[model samples]
Target: MKTGVMLSCLGIGVLGLTACGGAASSALDSYKPATVNTPEDAKRWAKNASAPNVYLSSTAVLGITGLNGQGQAEDTTCPKRNQDGNTLWLEGDCTDSEGRKWVGKARRESEAAGSDTGRFVYEGFGYEGTDTCGGKEIAGKWIFEGVVDVTGTEEEIHFDIDVRTDFTGPDEDADCAVSDESMAWDYTGTVVEDGSSKNTWSGSGRVGSSKIGVATVETKDEVIDMSVCDSEAISGTTTLTGGSDTVVITYDGATDCESSSTVQWSLNGEAKGELTGVSCASAGSAPAWALLAWPAVMLLWRRRSRDVRGGRGRRRI
Candidate 1:
């Protein structure tokens, strides 16, 4: 399928570089997706360059890129959690069970020996920058804080940039056939649960400046939310910027899980097509977002009330 779309959500800012030699140094092209950045001197020392308690959070992204005619991509992270009691950090293509996957494991250096730190090891599927077997390219870092639980009918999470991939390379790996490079975006999202098996997250994102010029995509409150579990499916819609366009998301499947869920997005109710892989995480494990808004009870209640009620609309998809 088309993996390029997946990179869109993960932030493909690794493009637009000026490489002098033909050596494929970074993890993506190395075929060693998982082990892209072992504890090298420069890279290792950079870890301590941040706060002590901050660990990386794991992310599993599956989506299509608009560039490569909406190609498909899946990415995950290893060592599900960090030493600082944080979840695993992730980068590109975590869902592929078969491919040049990046499996990360942390090791504890002896603290008595003037070192008691964790080091991550990336193991690629095959030797020579190629999975050979599954052809997967992966790279990214993780920094996480503990999960904060929201004390409401819904779950919420709070986090920061605990893990990030390197963004140093040519503007575009255009010749590679797949535009699967690091990209970035600046947007906000919200997830509302309409029912047990139905939920939706909608947000806006923009592209960062690399070799490729800056590109901004505004959803304009364009909500892409859905709930699909076992018996029934729910749908939702949000208007985008410029008011000329809108995306309507629909779910068709079960009511509690996302497996085999069919999500279709439409513009002004016109069927765009079937969206194969759509992954979005609006809140963190913790209710951090909720906690921050707690001080403003009136505001918090209003937002939560809208979420629940808005979910009930259930119009035709």
Candidate 2:
């Protein structure tokens, strides 16, 4: 379905490039609906309307932290680092085999340098890059600031993150059919070693040229079991509203890591559709922009961790 294609294109920018083009058309700032006269109509509207949840998930926030849902660094492209007194500066450019390019810089300060216990604060961390996938080329930028606190002998870790992103691309289909396309969002969340997390997201943008107007995403406590799943919100609700029509999506909780989840969709207070299996974490999901954008920052942290703790890695708390 074009729903997956829309997500794949958005995923191309998660860790992507600079914003070089005009801002997405403001006309896409509000939802403009197609006629919904049948269950099929409601089904299509529900899928497209609820698609943004994929990008709004905690997984996307983790992408900004340069870590996957599994709390592992998956990107190998590292940015250059320079040590300046107690502060470490990272700046450089990297290109992946897929021809995606990333350029950015970040500043981090060590709270307790040369001590067995380590605490770091990341300031002014951001990057921009671009990638082409599923017949679309996306360019975007990401900016974030957070603190990583490590305490005790086991070196328990905890982090609070805030992130902002702006991405622009042609909203198109597999055949290269162009439509309205753009996305921008703000995401914030926290992850602890116990595999629990909470997130809140809000944004106004377009997916596959479809206007999302203003939307907010939220996940319940322990809704995403990091030990069992990779950033999928096994239980949560996302609401999208424009004019008098509204769409709501509910993700049914699961027990294991599954590619798809059971979801229910409703429009204007009426049930429209229910699907037993909906892919939410695959490479082709909406966070594909993150897959491409996060590597540069991920590489930076991987290098930093290697230089510290003598190869003993820090678990994401």
Candidate 1 accuracy as lDDT: 0.23
Runs in model 2 deviating more than 4 A are 1-78, 85-87, 93-101, 108-182, 190-212, 226-236, 254-259, 276-317
lDDT of 2 at 59: 23
Q: lDDT per residue, candidate 2, 209-252, as tens digits?
A: 23333333332332444344553445556554444556666665
C-alpha lDDT of residue 244 in model 1: 41
C-alpha RMSD by candidate, in order: 17.8, 10.9
Clashes of 2: 21
lDDT of each: 0.23, 0.35
RMSD of 1: 17.8
User: Measured by TM-score, how close is model 1 to the native structure?
Assistant: 0.31
